[model samples]
Target: MPGFSFETAERTHVGCVRKLNEDRVLSRPEVGLWAVADGMGGHQAGDLASSMIVDALSSIELLGTGYAFLDEVQESVQRVNRTLVSHARLSRPGTVIGSTLVALLIYDGHFACLWAGDSRVYLLRDGRLNQITRDHSMVQELIDSGALQRADAPYYGRSNVITRAVGVNDRLALDIASGPIQEGDVFLLCSDGLTGMMDDDEIEAVLKARTADDAADHLLKVTLDRGAKDNVSLVLVHVEPSVDDTLRTARRTLLA
Candidate 1:
């Protein structure tokens, strides 16, 4: 398995309506870890919960390659979940402090997507964009059960309600998906704040037209323009073949 290099960019905004931003974005390209956490529970608690998630992730040290690296990422997220639960019990009692998490980990030509709640991970490859994670929200459940149409989701009063999130329970159940890495692969990890305001097609269009940093900026601007009712956060990652690998291939070709 060959290692790759990543180009990453991230942004988080308080939004027009919210007085406080409870969303947190993590961009640790050196360690191949990136995530977006959207907090829920009110100003102080929500901000605390989201910050706890990113802080725990930022502390993760790469122990080994491949699966070992992925293990560390998962463990770190779970560790934070427990810490948040404990904190709520001891300090906030009866009030839930939780955050939705969506993370991307790439190592040794493999990529893993882990998430809970509505925050999402999207991949753009060969000019097509695909969503990698499903939302664990009330509206999603309704749509899955054929009780509600996807078009009407935004109009539902409880559309913002999530069914699963870190720190909301004693144990966190994250959905993990993995696949082989591809050069020119672009990944977008974002809080529901961005998705809630813009549909998948609109997001895909912006990502297709700009570089990682520009896409992130454009997405935030569009969200704000469209009435960003919630805090918006996003991380954009672009994977490419390592310079050493490319050089080696060129040298081999010249000799042959």
Candidate 2:
């Protein structure tokens, strides 16, 4: 399979109130791996947990078909989960040290999104935005079960309470979704810091109006402007036509 090339950008901020930024972002376009990890154990441990997650993923070297690559990505995440769990038990027993993970893997015109927390993966195609990953948070559960209305989620005070996260437990359950990539599709991977500050509509507008590079910066700026209470991080990817397709079009234009 011919590999699909992409335009990618990422950003992270400490926010106005936080003394330290616990959020970590990885943009390895060479391996087509991008991720955002938001740590949750305060200053000392939160940064450590998030950085560990990014380090583990960055060390992965996948050289196979798309599905095989996806498998390796999942395995890598699970391996890090176990490692973090053990480290926490030995170093800081009874203290929670975990991070929320959301990752995107693109290969051979195929893309896979894997996540474990409120951090999200969104696909913007044909001017419409679709969320590819669901939030494993307490408020999401309430909205799903009809206890809380979707419109009222922003007002909920406990929106930060996530039900699942990486390194939080011995057995980590990640949600994975895969699909074929389309030309002109834009994939947005972000931490809750962005979502907590802006609604879906506001996010969509920014994504629609800006290029991937500009979009990442603008999103972070907007979040900070709105009082980013927590660490903010995001990865933006713009999918383009394959090399073969672009060359073919050029050839036809030459003949014409």
Residue pairs that clash (backbone atoms under 3 angstroms), model 2: none
Provide TM-scores for the models: 0.94, 0.95
Indicate which candidate wins on TM-score. 2
Query: lDDT of model 1 at residue 54?
Result: 91
Per-residue accuracy of model 1 over 1-256 as CA lDDT, tens digit each:
6668898999999999999999999999898899999998984998998899899899888767778887887888888889888888887558889999999998878889999999999999998999999999999999999999999988999988899999989878899999988999999999888988999899889988999989989999999999899999999999988879889999999999
Instruction: Put down candidate 2 lDDT per residue, 1-256, tens digits, no spaces.
Output: 4446789999999998889999999999888899999998874788888898899888889777888888888888888789878878887557778899999998878889999989999999999999999999999999999999999999999999999988889999989999988888999999988898898899999999999999988998989998999889999999876688789889999999
lDDT of 2 at 51: 92
RMSD of each: 1.7, 1.5
